[model samples]
Target: MVGREETTMFHRDLHPDGRPVKPEEREQLLRKVLPPTSYSDETTRSTSPKPVGRKRRILWSRFVTRIHLILFAIIQAVFSIYLRSRYLYHVIIDRIYTIMYYPHRTPEYIRRDVKALSRLPTHISVILDLHSHDRYDADSSLENLVNDVCEICAWTASAGIPVLTIYERTGILKEYLQDTHRAITQTLRSYYGQHPPSISLRAPHLQSISPPRSPNTLPADATPPRLEVTLISKDDGRATLVDLTKTFAEMAQNRKIGPEHVTGELIEQELSDLTMKEPDLLILFGPNVQLQGYPPWQLRLTEIFNVEDHQGVAYHVFLRALHCYGKAQMRFGR
Candidate 1:
């Protein structure tokens, strides 16, 4: 039962073949089987030393990475500059001239750059309502209105653009014209009779009025009275419309009539008139802040501009407006 004991050897023991265990041999085996404790020291002492240029190669790779980052930044900057130059050349300068020379296009001039587009004309017509002075009432200052008109005429004449005035009603036109004539005479007398630009007030051909409605107008069982629109034929449809908004305001203030009643009446009258008149465009001014029941039918077809400040109506603004009209696309809700 007693067997021979198995032999055991220390790490420094000789091999079973009886060769002495060399330190180099042991270290070589350890180097292959285990991670290095300190590569710098161990590698320096090794018999087969690493190539001397290995450190230099690693440094060269880092330098190459840095150079690549710098080149990428420079390329990005050059691309940005090229794109900006292209936009300025193609969209801003080139397109503006092309738009200007296009055929069948009317030129509108603006004194100030109201729109963001880069190109437009230098002269245009402007029809404006005189808000500084009252449009209605027998006692308001017709002289002030005339002065404003004179300024507008001078501006238009200077810009080589034609201008026109529209009357909301015949009665208002007649009154305005009479007062304008008187104002011209007075100004001439004061300034030694100088001839001023000939200004005229235009009126729609037909005036639509709501018929007086009573219980008898519609039977008790019948629906309430409704407006019967009458069509009138006319040629001078593009006259500048003047709304007597101030008059209506005054009337409402005095309780002579409700604002709704006045607005309704005006809307009825103007809608019918405008359908026949067929104005080219609408210029809203004065106290006529919300179109004020004026020419709804014509308005659908007309381009509108609001100029509440009568004194600020410059020739340039008028020119720009005309230019805008020239450039407008009239597709009718297409």
Candidate 2:
């Protein structure tokens, strides 16, 4: 017996009335049967176009970069202008001062004046600021300082300056005395090889004057002069001052002298007796003109000249300092 084939129903074709459905209708029926799912706002937004703030942020970033560049350029321009103006001001001022104060003083005139005055200062002291070591290139700065000292010594010798004292706060010159002496000797030999003046470290005692040669010494000044170089440090000043005070106190106690009797002159004399001679001229090589703890007693009548940045200092600078010293008129409390 022939039987009718049984019909099968797929999930998409299923309906309450048992009728077949199209693809679109089946999709709609499935959607109604399933529960609704919740989606995050961020997920939904990400699927759409970016918001207005994104374009604004991009524009703001570009604006900030341009502003930074503009600010940097402006700062550089201002700094350049300031430096140029400063340089111009210095040039104008220097020219005016030179014209007014040094009208007849040509370079040759200044040099001659310095040479003549160099012979006058029996004891000249150079004070170097050791504190500037950190600010400069160490090796180059030291080399420059050594060369400067050597040149100054040779020049002093040439000009018949009898004694030179080099002072530093750290005793650096004292520590390098041998090297300094050798450098000075070399410099003198290089400059005046034929008849180099006798340069030696000054002894602690007062230098003795040679007795007149057989009473026919050509006015007692014809003999060749000697160049005595002394290396002094802050330690010398401190030690001398301490010793001087102690001695003065002891003498006063023993002699029953009052405080009024121990005058500044007395102290000065005592210090001079201890240290031998006071400096006639004191040249300071530093940033400022003030003496950085130099021996107070020695500077009573000393003419001080300041030259900034002693490293690689030219011979003309030293000559200029000497010229200044020569021109200065000291009243000494007239």
Candidate 3:
């Protein structure tokens, strides 16, 4: 019965004439229909030997990886050392230059340049980085500060700059304005053998209106020209702008005027009445270009110049700053 069933299954592919297929044809058809038998795991294991060079390749890869890591570390170390050497070299060179080739500007040369400027700034402001004060011995730092202030005063006196403002970050100058002013004036008088200028000191809270002067009232060569020296510090802060704006807003509310009526001219006039006039040129003496929380309202149209390492800075450096400012083409919000 089993043989008959198998024959029936095989006969399903027979020709329509009902003739049984030939043995060679039936064998070929069986070969095409059946799946090939797979080898057992044991047979594969016996036939295939383990790859000969796998361990060698792994060891070589590890060795190469270690070599790459070692090279990268060496390169990193070399680059770090190079950067350190470069920085030290630059510092040494800067010190050498300061000791040897730094140019000193004479009072006559400064005066000449001041006159040569197409239009001299009416007011000049200076920012001193007192954070650097700890770099030197306390006494030496104080002496240097005095000398720097005196040098600035001498420059302003020579250039006939009428208004000079000084700012420090921590109120150091503001706290010692009387002592600093006395020292600066004494140094100027001793050095120049004449009164330098009328230096009027004012605090941030103080308000004083300068008397109006008619144009052409003062001669060109006015000796000991009226110099207004204003000293301010962090105590003033940026609240000057905020306070001014608030005052104007309150005023507008009280007067029942529109906020648009509060114009910049009016704000500036009020500020001038409270503080000194806005600075035209701001000379920052430090390693960085940051203002370090300087009054923002005054710097809107100001030209800024930076001097690196201003402690015991050369006079020619100050002159060069002025020269740069003179060459600058100012477009006051054109």
Best candidate (score: lDDT): 3
How do the residues 247-277 of candidate 3 rate in per-residue lDDT, one tens digit apiece? 7778777986687777888877777766667
User: Where does the lowest 10-residue lDDT sum fall in candidate 3?
Assistant: 206-215
Q: Could you tell which candidate, 1 or 2, scores higher by lDDT?
A: 2
Backbone clash count for every predicted candidate, in the order shown: 11, 0, 0
Residue 321 lDDT in model 3?
A: 70
lDDT of 2 by residue, 128-220 (tens): 655454446766656666777787787677556788877766666555666777787777667654345567764233352222324342344
Candidate 1: deviation at residue 236, Å? 14
TM-score of model number 1: 0.32
Residues 184-286 of candidate 1: C-alpha lDDT, one tens digit per residue? 3344233222323233333345433332334544444533112121211223232323344555678789999895686655754664444433345444433
Q: TM-score per candidate, in order?
A: 0.32, 0.56, 0.64
Report each candidate's C-alpha RMSD, comma-separated, in the order given.
20.0, 13.1, 11.3
Better of 2 and 3 by TM-score: 3
Rank ordering of all candidates by TM-score, starting from the highest: 3, 2, 1
Query: Which candidate tops TM-score?
Result: 3
Judge candidate 1 against the unseen true structure and give its global Cα lDDT, from 0 to 1.
0.45
Q: Which window of 10 residues has the lowest lDDT sum in candidate 1?
A: 224-233
